[model samples]
Target chain A: MTEPKTAIAIQGLEKVYPGGFRALQPIDLEIYQGEIFALLGPNGAGKTTLINAVCGIVNLSAGQITVNGFDHCTQYRQARSCIGLVPQELTTDAFETVWNTVSFSRGLFGKSANPALIESILKRLSLWDKKDNQIRMLSGGMKRRVMIAKALSHEPQVLFLDEPTAGVDVELRKSMWDQVHELRETGVTIILTTHYIEEAEEMADRVGVIHKGKLLLVEEKNKLMKQLGKKEMVFELQHPLETVPPELCGKNISLAAGGSQLVFTYDTLQEDNGVTDVLDCLKAHHILYRDISTRQSSLEEIFVDLVRAS
Target chain B: MNFQGIKAIYRFEMSRTFRTLGQSIASPVLSTVLYFVVFGSAIGSRINDINGVSYGAFIVPGLIMMTVLSQSVANASFGIYFPRFAGTIYELLSAPLSFVEVLMGYVGAAATKSFVIGIIILFTAGFFVPLEVKHPIWMVAFLALTCVTFSLLGFIIGIWADGFEKLQLIPLLVITPLAFLGGSFYSIDMLPELWRKISLANPVVYLISGFRWSFYEHSDVHLSVSIAMIALFLTVGFAIIAWIFKTGYRLKN
Candidate 1:
């Protein structure tokens, strides 16, 4: 297929900190327009550092970044104006009212004041009632929502959320996720960094994994699952046995639950899974089963496995 | 030249100052009044007129300089330092504002605050001492220039200092002592010959002398020297600030 329109393109990006710490190796990735891309990585995997570099909080040691069509350094103003960043830290001006802070954020991007647009954003984020309240007076979750509102105030074409759901309650997380979906519907490209594999699995059209300051892989979410996913068949025996039968000992199977259950693991990509042969072996051995079930490996397991290999 | 961005930052900083009226405006005014009561009454009686101006009037320029210098530095330093301390600086860093625009917003607000305070102290001094302005225009110029220069100094200190104690370091240990010795409370002319020579080294002397000349046309140094010194300091402050932004010193990691 022809290449999709790119929203953000990072080429040969690398960051070497002052103390000789290599925070990121060379990374090249392109996020397509109007897509929800999840950057999944564990703690200290340079996920935040990468985002900070893109946002201009950290100076890049090497490489180039382009947001939409503007160069991040040479065309800094236009590049910055096109992007919004909801930082990992909940840093707000304590004495400022929610309304003023959010409005000020919009002006920071050289945008004219649009009160009606701001009002709608507040109402959408459930912050309309607290608009007059000082930011410090709001709860942690509300403060997070204020950060989101501030990020959106500028009407950026691309948004970066660095661990948006971190330290958030499950209910608030759900609401934030719904809000993100609504924003995406407006054709805003979103790239979020999260350690919650379930979050990536639930929301991302594509997933990128980073570990040890290196991007290990980037692929479409469904294709990744289908390529790496494994299946397991579990058999509940009609009677318990002291040990596995001699004939089935060499197969990729294990007897567990005091030999009352048998589990057979197989790669989903392989055609000859040996299910029929295994069943014939079971019949010849006079083994009977009460029930059978199959399960596919989850994204979390795939994430853990990826990290471990690196 | 993002005027809107500069305005947003300026308004935000000014509003913060207004929010803490007791600490920012009231306390400084109250302290200046107490200084007038103690020094004007107690010391004014013992000392005769210097350079044909009354002791109380002569010290008016000095006292205003003392208050304006320290306060300008303190206000500007705190204004920028608190944002860094709170981690809210990241928002500004990520915004589309150029470094110069950001500097203008912060330094402009700080200079304005100090100028207003200096004017209030001048009015308050009038209640106790008879004051005259020989060159009213020059008086206003000196007051404004000094405020802007010291405010810039404070901005540099704010970025250089990484902690609370360090933030107060130069203002307390360096600038305040320099102001005291630079003839805020006593004229360098009153000092012994050797001390007079030593006092000339203090940068605050030029500021106070130039400012005092505006009020009485009497100064320890020539009018041009004071004016040149002020310009030189202002240039240095701007140069340092420009370098900081260019190198991303203490701003970007």
Candidate 2:
């Protein structure tokens, strides 16, 4: 079998500040080429720290990180040349025009002047019309697009977006995702961190869950969903009762609101999810239900559960 | 250092400085004119000559140097401080530009601004006193050197300062007082021997002496010593800035 090519390789990454705070703890990860990798984590989970370390913004306390075989520290310029980072905050020289900002960012990366490329990037981001306007005059969403334009100016092979849509509107969020998807198609490996689980579900080929500076799990998106997803069944009683009967106790069924409703939670991956047994017992006890409904756990539910567990 | 990066950054910083033209250019020009009015008219009649030049012309170099130093410091410090305040330093840090590129871009823009303002002040002074340049070449050279030195010093201050108030603290408290005490409006020779020696301890005194010597061809301090002090200041200033960049002080953390 051929060896899998890696775009980014990190081993035993650790970042400990001088004040005894361990921001990152021995993280090991490998990102494949041209893959959309989503790092899902809550606040203070060291997502930014990891990204900063890879981009050479933050010095590493201990670890090895290489970008396309270039060491992040030793070959910082080469490694940085291959990666474009759009930080979480909207940061740009406010007095500069949108066009100037993008072009200047390209120059900062040692790229020659390419007005044609910059123009196309602006048009793609819907910023062509606003190209001559000062960045301070732009709206929040437009400023966010300018950040994207700046990052893309160098034509980097790998792009890291830290919460690209944290405060964006719904339409822009979808459009941003589309742009990300399009970039991936152009052979750019994209790594993004988002609190929005739907973004990961809709966009990520591989999902890595980070909690409290630790990698909780990393797997293919569909595989992770298939492995951890659960189902819930709720029943409305025909007649309201003051209390639950002892029969449903051992089955893990919970009485809701004076026994008027019963709730059952089960793992969806199980062949026999125990819903049938619970219904059988209810029928055997002559309990009548007016209605029944079931719901499958979403990525949001799984994410919440994983974060809560950690 | 990438020249393209430096040019891009220089253009960006220049536009930023120019955007507040009323404050950066007009305010300084107006203040300089006012200095020529208040000090030149009031003191020129009392002190007949300073090193064989009219008192009005004598104070011109000191005033111009004062403006150059303060404006260079203000421009460079604010150039770096505002980006940090607006949280744009992260963008610069993550970019492929090296530290040297960043420093040169900011300091170059700052020196340009101060140099422009210094010329404006000199012209504005021309309207008041009949000024003559004894050595135009040396004058321009010292002007450029002084602007560069102070601009680099301002860059260091910008990197070290965390807040707008802190940025203002050094220029307002330390640099301004030193410039004033360095004898922009008066000659150090008029002071007592002990006081004159104490004033020599001020670095601004050398800058003023060098500038005054270029204009009058005579000065309280030797021209060579002034030039030497400015060179030493440049060396020390560059060293501190390079060290800060290497350590990523205030920039990274």
Candidate 2 residue-wise lDDT, A1-310, digit = tens: 9776799999999888778898888999999889999999999999999899888787788899999999887787788889999999988777789988898889888888999999999999999999999999999999999999999999999999999998999999999999999999999999999999999999999999887778888899888887888777988999876666788777767778677888788887788878789989989999899999988788888889999998
- What are the models' TM-scores? 0.97, 0.93
Top model number, lDDT = 1
Ten contiguous residues with the weakest lDDT in model 1 chain A: A265-274
Please give the distance, in angstroms, between residue B197's alpha carbon in candidate 1 and its true position after superposition.
2.5
At residue B45, candidate 1 shows an lDDT of 65
User: How far in Å is the alpha carbon of A254 misplaced in model 1?
Assistant: 3.3
Model 2's CAPRI class is medium
The parts of candidate 2 lying over 4 Å away from their true place are A1-3, A233-248, A255-262, A268-294
